[model samples]
Target: MTPEGKALSNIVILGFGFMLMFTAFQTCGNIEQTVIKSLNNFTASGYTSMSIIYGVFSASNLVAPSVVAVVGPQLSMFFSGLLYSAYIAMFIQPRVWSFYTASVLVGFGAAVLWTAQGNVLAINSTDTTIGRNSGIFWALLQFSLFFGNLYIYLAWQGHDHISEKDRQTVFISLTVISLIGCFLFFLIRKPDPSEPTPSETSEAPLHTESTDSASVSGPPRRSLCTQALDAFVKACKLSVTKEMMLLCLPIMYTGLELTFYSGVYGTCIGAMTRFGHNAKGLIGISGILIGVGEILGGGVFGILNNNRLGRNPVVLLGLLIHYLAFYLIFLNIAPDAPQAPEEGTDLQAYMTPNVGVALFCSFLLGLGDSCFNTQLLSIIGFLYKEDSAPAFAVFKFIQSIMAAIAFSYSNVLQLPWQLLLLVVTGFMGTLSFFMAEWGVVAKRRDSDYDSI
Candidate 1:
């Protein structure tokens, strides 16, 4: 097959595998807080476990580039998939010790999984095709939202609360689904090293220098520990670059907002008594709507935005939409919604809660999330083509740290307070993104002028 065909095939396989895996994981995650809270005596256990997951994920990213470089993306992904499966299977019994232990392990696994994913995707793409490839991958991956949540809604509708028996059955089914996805990783083909890259000519000398140094026979081949430490140091340096520094806020914003829609907002919907006893089931509906919004946004920004509109406009659009969603969430949901159910508290916001409006806000949040993520993926791929693994590791490091912080506070913060934080961060992140874009343009223009 042609190199392009092979590249496209790898992307499709990766997308399908992720869709299946995350469909199961995310479906379980969407209900994790509510379900775990229901089965266990501790109400905050769900939030705390999630916090641990992201915290470990944040630290693990420091070493993820080294792991990816040593094992390669396919094996890294396959092994990480196992960790995710272990985490999901724990829901069957739901012990605090077992659950939290799995959370820590899964956190480490997540760092490797995501970094390897970015590394592989970057390897398979060039500047011209990266956006479209990212879009195709994202669109397929986000479809998990539709299929998984639809099942949850159907299986869970009309239930006031999830039962232990129901939880067991749900998790067992999801575990099987995730395992199938994991096996698909074995089928992926690595990109040929011989394939041409836009930066290949410029980067050849660097590769040659490293190879020559390694071949001197004066020292043993760098051990995995040494390699990992080197990669970790490189990622740290990359994180402090002017371009990466400018992009940090926007990167961190993705983490914060991602935690919101993925876990917190759905919890609020579940806790809302105004939606009736079936409100708990409405989390599935919200997930579905959010999935719809995410799929649409991924298609537009990732696929359609390829060479047309610049990234900054798409990010600004995301910011505006998120602001709208936040306003509606503030008006329609209770101020203390994140902390307690309506039955637990008498508080209400400016307007009475409406299920329709709540779902719409979820949709908007999903759409905006896609805009930010797709653009960020493309931007990183374009700018750091040669250093894709370490660059992506740096991005994930900052993103996961913010996610860890957000999850830590998710249960403690009221709904209004959370919305306020998002609004402020969204503004700052958008402005930073614009600055980064401007810098890239100016740098490129100068390079072009110098060449003439």
Candidate 2:
């Protein structure tokens, strides 16, 4: 095939691949949330949360570069889907060992999956299109959130307490969906490395628009050990930059928010019900609202992908949105807010007067989350384009560690302490924006446009 033909083909493959994997990833996330409610026990869910995060988020990051270099992005995603399925399968009978073991596998899988996807997408696109590409990727991925939550909303629509059969039914279907991702991953071909352009080979970190861009094809392959060590060395150097360090603060904050939304927020919703407050059932409606917010936020961000105002305005807006959501969460968390569960199993009671505002708050959280996460990807990919593998590796490593801490301590925090934690993190997230180089990709893109 012609080089241009190959490049166009690779882009289409990547765009579709992004859509498929995240569908499974986000679905599994929603299912986990629902499962926690179904089990109606915080301790098991906590162990699951802590262990899985360590496995999927923390430990895998330690070796992400080597893994991606060895296996390539398509293979990396293939295995990631498997790990996710393993975790989903454990929900059927979540013993301590089973849960923890599955979590580790999922962690490794997630690290590789994310690293590969980011590398492939960023490396293949031009500097001018990175924002748009990442935005599109995020927009596609967030759809899974919508579908997953919609499923939860439908399944738990009228259920009082979720029965064992219900849990089995929901989980079994989620596992099936996750397996489909594995199949989709098999269909993608790695981008060709023969071109002299900046895009990566299957065996190298992405350098499409990087300051330190290099071609992997010109030299003989390095040993995996040497490659891994070199990757780590570069990441360590980038890790020391003020911009990188400052930006990490927000990424870590994102980890905290993830744990809260995934674990604590569900518990809080259950608590709003009259049937023992924190009773076990799906917080489907709330989850749906959050997904809706994410979809809207991502779409808006993608549309404004061409904005010359730089990333600063969007990030600042994200900060404002998340803070507002956090404040509402703090205020309306009272026992009587949702007016308790009705006599039947209908969940409509939880949607009563006081809960509407909190649900809107959830919507805002999703929106804010999209703003920060999408921009963070664009910024990191742009700044460290040549070193994207390590940049993202470091980012994921810190995010996972902070998330692990949050999950470990989540159960012990009462409302007041949780509120305090949110406040601190939100402030840190806001500060992170100022610390980062604002509108870097935008400016670069504008210059590229001028040159053209």
lDDT on C-alpha atoms for all candidate structures: 0.83, 0.65
Model 1, residue pairs in steric clash: none
What candidate 1 gets wrong by more than 4 Å, as runs, is 40-44, 199-226, 341-346
Rate residue 121 of model 1 by lDDT. Answer: 80
For residues 1-452, what per-residue lDDT tens digits would candidate 1 score against the true structure? 88788878988999999999998988888988778657646433777888899999999999898887666677788899999999999989877788899999999999999988887787778878888888888888898888878878888888877787888988998999899999997777655557756633333322222223434532334664575677778788888899899999999999999899999998888888788877777888999989898999988898655654578899999999999999999998887777684343445789988889999999999999999999888888888877777888888889988998998898788888888999999999999999998887788789989999
Per-prediction TM-score: 0.93, 0.83
Worst 10 residues of 1 by lDDT: 202-211
User: How much is the lDDT of residue 176 in candidate 2?
Assistant: 78
Total clashing pairs in model 1: 0
Distance (Å) between predicted and true CA of 4, model 2?
7.2
